[model samples]
Target chain A: MSEASKSARPDGSNRPAVQLRSAVALLGSFPALAGVDLDVHHNDVALLQGPNGAGKTTLLRLCAGLIGPSSGTAMVLGQDVGSANGRRRVRRSVGLMGHSTALYDDLTVEQNVQFWAAASKAESETVVPALDRTGLAGRLQTVKVSALSAGQRRRTALAVLLCRRPSLWLLDEPHAGLDKDGRELVNGLVLEAKDAGATILIASHDLDWATSVATRRIDVVGGRVVEGTVVEDAVVKGTVVKDADA
Target chain B: MLSDARLIAAKDLRIEASSRVLLTQVLPFGLMVLLLFGFGISPDRQVLGEVPRRSVLEQVSPGLFWITVLFAALLGLGRSFSIEAADGNLDGLRLGGLDPAGIFLGKAAAVIVQLAVLEVIVGVGAILLFGVSLANVGLLAVTIVGATVAIGCAGTLYATLAAGQRVRETLVPLLVLPVLAPVLLGATQATEAALFGPVSDGWPWAGLLGAFALLYIAIGIVAFGSFLEES
Candidate 1:
């Protein structure tokens, strides 16, 4: 397996992996996310909590450079997302997984991991181990991806994401298909990724699980950043509130 | 661009290799189609064969070849997208930084290469079964390449576009086959001339086929990124 495709600007590793300015993105002529200004330092694990269609996915997509903003610009390491080259670089650095369950069901567990590892430019040495870490060790050779159960498939997908060694991680609803043990496995993976100098930003509805895992929280409601607080020691109910308008 | 293209191509070829019996089924299916063509035309070879290969090729060859290739292709294209849609693999690739174009190229290359192999098999079957004689191997090869390239590009595009829809199975072919009519006509006509001696002097119908291939490739590259945004 080859390495994944990460951005290799000479100054890529000089500063933090991701930085965002006033990013505005509209979906269906309505603002999906607007006035999103923030900065994330290297290896910082920040949680984004919001309801469905609260611009969580849009913001993540903006930060990942998967789509362009409606008006304002989003910069990854100070490069614009609107340009093709900028978007490529941002995509290389950022690893995003959401409700879409991005794994390919037709491939086997190992092939699934290897494909992403090759794309993200990750080291090949980690491929087998990532599979093993996700509790998919011996099943590599014969298991077709479609045959695996939901949690098992998510485990394999996680294994693939871990192999990439991305500088920035953008996760939307990361805990979707994981069991309790699987969630712990995800937490370990996130911690391990962070330890490797990767910044983590997760958008999830499971507040207790998310708050426990994150050091700070940003609340988005109806396409606006209503609360961008760095909750030092805040609990889920006290610090986080769903927008009535949402 | 070449390095990126080569990388994608390699991945695509690797995927086709890893899959079980992809080409095996193709050759057999082509042979069966050849048998069907033989049975259909045997009753009236004089009626079908003597009327100039151009007319026969124009009306039936492209559709027949595409029908054969499309049936073979449909087996794997959905699997390509379905693989990603499963367990969030698309997100993994997105997060892993695979360029959507590179990814599409890789997947499309696999389909194109597979279709080419199948086309060769079908061509051989057609020759044996339909009694079509190829006077120019080069022209025939070029024509096949053009048709298959067009089919592959357009097929990959629709497959990606229909990745998550309710009626993806029926919708893809409905979208692709209509747009593919020109390539089918062009390929069939060019192949006929290459087989049954020259019909249009030295114009060489392969050029039209090649142009059509290039056009579809450009469309695939440009529009592929847009399909990823489909809800």
Candidate 2:
């Protein structure tokens, strides 16, 4: 078994993680999500794709407990994420990273992570593991976010995400501003988190990584989702994932 | 449920603490307004001295206090939401599980803090400028506190409602002043009675101000959640 598969069950057991049912969003009071349904079982990485203004962010936010769907309901770990209690349960168990770093520029990287940790009321002891997991060990002690390069700032923000290792990770455009090494490191972290029973839902336009990484893929356009068959095309260095394939 | 309120309020309070000093400085301007009352009420010292200082304050302070408070509160109300809205921070905060009323309380609290500090400065300035002594200082202080609370809640609610409009600055006072006239009349009258006459003299007006504040709090809580839909 790969090291990641072994870590999937720290004690050696498999279990499903997240499920969504008939989730729908309306733009112009019409279905944007279009009665979408999905599942991300334990260790399953899902890629969500969409054209511009296609309810991609809306779907992510709805799952993140940041928004409520107009009609259909959603469930994370068998709990409805839209209800008050369910939203709290989901927020505590999920870490969401988006285009915005959500970091305070003036605070040091460590201070920024700690403040978010404190705000979320996360355990103090978990801070270092979170920082180390994001590969920010060297920068943890010092370095203001504004002082860091674009990629480094994303790492710091990712470190903030690690402060609370949510069971479900929803990332919107997590690959932006990443160099080759940074992207690989982030992909590894996502894969590793999945192995640890953290189901991953990543939205991206770059189908190569999404296909290479995710077990399932969903496509959205104009707030409507269309399912595409997985295609495997070999690339020089990595897999060439083709979703537009007929 | 109030935890929702506290969590949202804490965010705005942290931001508002930085501006409390600047907001309070407007009291000097309010004091100038009070000093202007001296000129209007009595052009010459002979006429002013004929009436006892306490009587002169009782007759003039009510109108002057409201005018000064209205102008000073305009400065604070202008700030309440447009500051947060400038950078899309308001939507960010809403995304973080904060309730709308929580935002309302935080904005109102910032206004209240400013009013309290300004009241102290204006109170002292009013005394210095008009030669009016506060015989019942404790009661007068209470009245100042009440009036400011009325202004803060009333002002914040209006500011938020107008925040998205193109002419929000103009819209805020226009919406607030008409609805809040009773609060002004009550609070200013209460202040006059407290500063110059017996505490009993101000109870009716104080009661009126108290009711106004409560009404604003109630209305703000119920209506704030629907702000984005309307805006």
Candidate 3:
């Protein structure tokens, strides 16, 4: 798994974990990611902050190979993410945690994690320790996800992420719906994964919470990454992008 | 690839077992459809004893059986994707590294399992309630397998096409039913020939059904990735 994560270019140098060159993606004729250019290296913890509809989620989805760039190139782990073979290979080594927990309402927590773990080609035995790491050890294997609280549900999703051990973690709002303890678990997990050499890209509105763990931070607004700070402008609903030089 | 397909199919089947939605709801609805057709066709036989009830039922049983199976199978197809859409489990599956072709095959296979069980119960009920008998049971088997495969593959493919859309519920039937007209015609005619004798046209109908099934399976394998990404 570690060897697979070190995806090398033709010249044998390891490629940037994610690289987007003037990439454009459309959602219903509207550009979601409009001419975006960015790069993140291996083990880099890059944080993305923006107002709603600023293309944060779209960028993450693009990196996850869930959406293709309408124009330009979006590469992840040396693969052109727009291609089918590239997307399939990228999916094998990347994990994306989005708004949804993605857990089955009827399946038990253990079963949910086990299913993902196996799908990610991890050993089934990793499920137990993953659950333990996420502080869901008390929940019985028979307990359904629908029966769990919001925090517990988040923890279960975290457990699946831990077990999969993806090379790249694309997380959108990791702290959403989590309590203080749950947030701390997320913080520790991110740092831990980075220490183990996994690249991380996180998109979140809560700048203060994410700032502490982020190695690099960028602001996005109006579907493009701006060299700016996010200001609370009531007119734009908290999406005022003020240039850094301003 | 087959292993991935088997894993996905197993997971889907486990979820179905836990919910019991197909068994408790869909199966009963199919039987009710059969019963309703029985009443609708044989209305007050004492008043109108012009045509024999047994002969009329026998004549209509092939169409009724296929219709009931199609309607009941719709329930499973809709629910199959609805469960995934509930919390974005579909995204999880996509990111889980399973090949898109494998996912399609696995989902279609699970639907086949469900429809096969539904067909057995409904077929038996049709035989008894409609007083229909089989002449060439072998041809009947061929028709069932080919038709069920056709429906399952087409259903899974079309269901994913509308997986996350607002009008997915209405859109699925519209997309799937029209495409499935050939399967219905072939299966119904094949069953008719199988039941009444000669087995002449039944073979050709079964062949057509098999061809449609293979075509769908191939299309699903090659096309699911693009369709899934769009959805």
Which scores better on TM-score, 2 or 3?
3
Per-residue lDDT tens digits of candidate 1, residues A1-246?
001112233455644345555677887688888767766555567788888889988888887877777676677755688776787677777777766656555567787677667776788898977777778888453487768877786777677677866677888888777777777677667766755667788899877667765756788888877776565543223323222121
TM-score of chain A of each: 0.84, 0.79, 0.86
- For model 2 chain B, give the 10-residue run with minimal summed lDDT: B87-96
Instruction: Point out the worst 10-residue segment of candidate 3 chain B by lDDT.
Output: B43-52
Ranked by TM-score, top first: 3, 1, 2
Model 3 interface CAPRI class: medium
- Predictions' DockQ, in order: 0.48, 0.15, 0.66
lDDT per residue for candidate 3 within B53-104, as digits (tens), equals: 3467678689999999998888889998988888988889888888789889
lDDT of 2 at B48: 51
Please write out the lDDT profile of model 3 over residues A1-246, one tens digit for every residue.
223223343356667889889999999899998999887767767789889999999999889887889998999988899887787778878889999889999889888988889888899888988887787776455698889888788889989999989888988999888887777778778877876778888899877667667766778888888863322221123222222121
User: Model 2 - which docking category?
Assistant: incorrect
Candidate 3 Cα errors over 4 Å, as ranges: A1-15, A228-246, B43-53
Distance from true location, Cα of A50 in model 3, Å: 1.4
Worst 10 residues of 2 chain A by lDDT: A237-246
Candidate 2 interface RMSD value: 4.6
Clashing pairs in 2: A32-A223, A54-A223
Q: State which candidate has the highest TM-score.
A: 3
Q: How close is every model to the real structure, measured as TM-score?
A: 0.76, 0.71, 0.89
DockQ of 2: 0.15
